[model samples]
Target: MLSDDELLRYSRQILLKQVDIEGQLKLKGSRVLIVGLGGLGSPVALYLAAAGVGELHLADFDSVDLTNLQRQVLHDSTSVGAQKVDSAIARLSALNPLARLVPHRTAMDVDSLDAAVAAVDLVLDCTDNFSVREAVNAACVAAKKPLVSGAAIRLEGQLSVFDSRVETSPCYHCLYGHGSEAELTCSEAGVLGPVVGMLGSLQALEALKLLAGFGEPLIGRLLLVDALSSRFRELRVKRDPGCAVCGNHNG
Candidate 1:
């Protein structure tokens, strides 16, 4: 049951036809795991907390750097050199003390990753490189948790949701196989602040939809965003029958 203050705080969200009191309650009961505290993780963490997610587990082994200020909205100048999770927790707690915030300041290994995924209702992949993304996907597949993945570099951004609990749904491994590729970083390629912010916001939206069971998630569909051209395109994707992570070929 929501306290009167919570009811008043989230009144706007509750008023939405797609998210009435019932949906709001569902959100209050959902636990979310957010991986990364960089550009994409910033907005994802902020919005999920503001929306009253019951608990949020933030994982980021990095620390705040001066370079992160431009796109990493969650950290401010004072946070320079501070642990990313510390900075995120301070900001998110200020936003909604009612929402629990757990910080994992260390890098996530396979054991820790699996443990985190198994405990959450949903996992948000705000990671940058393919390696972490692939590992996160495998963990979610084994745990059968829904994963909302987002990425941004330069003026481009993309969002996708992979729910392993659904038999026909695609996992990240289905989209990007276990292959090596040039890893791009915002520092080298240069990402517009708003570009990553846009995807991060949408990532939060998709997570909320999945948790509240209110709308169609991005599952099996990739939403491509070109901030420079102001264009949005979506490509339909499907599960790979031979996907090692979520296919029968696991053997």
Candidate 2:
């Protein structure tokens, strides 16, 4: 049951017919795991916290760097030397104290990652590293949790949702198997701050929809954003029967 303060604090969102008191309660009950606290993770964490998600498990092994100020909005100049998860906790707490912040400060191995995924109701892949994304997706598949994945680099962005619980849904490995060895990072390739911000915001929106049980999620679909041209396109993705991560689970 929401206290008077919660009802008032979340009044605006509750006003929406799509998200009345019931949906707000759903948001309050959900637990989410966010991997990475970089550019993409920044806005994802911000919006989800602001929207009043009950628990956010923030996982980031890196510290805030001066370069991150360009797009990682959660950290400020004061946070330059701080751990990303610590910085995120500070910022998110200020944004919404009602939202619980769980910090995973150290790097997570396969076992730890699997345990984290199993603990959360949903998972968001906001990491830039393809290898990390692959690991996260595998963990989600093994845990049978929904994964919201987003990436941005060099003015381009991609967003998708993979839910192993749904037979028709494709896991991240099904979409990008053994991602390119030449994949570049934002530091190496350079990206517009807004590009990653936009993708992260959309990822938060997708998460809200999924957690609150309203609207269609991007399952089995990939959204491509070309910031250079200010154009958006989407492609239909099919589940791969031979996908090593989720193939055996899908009929």
Tens-digit lDDT string for candidate 1 (1-251):
98999999999999999998899999999999999989999999999999999999999999999999999999999999999999999999899999998888898899999999998999999988789999999999988899999999999998999998787799998987875768768888899899999999999999999999988999889999988899999999989888878896233
lDDT of 2 by residue, 1-251 (tens): 99998999899999999899999999999999999999989999999999889999999999999999999999999999999999999999999999988999998999999999999999999998888889999999988999999999998999999998899999988889898968888889899999999999999999999999999999989999999999999999999999998999877
Every model's Cα RMSD, please? 1.4, 0.7
| Model 1 stretches astray by more than 4 angstroms | 179-181, 249-251
Clashing pairs in 1: none
How do the predictions measure up, each by TM-score?
0.97, 0.99
lDDT of each: 0.92, 0.94
lDDT value for model 1: 0.92
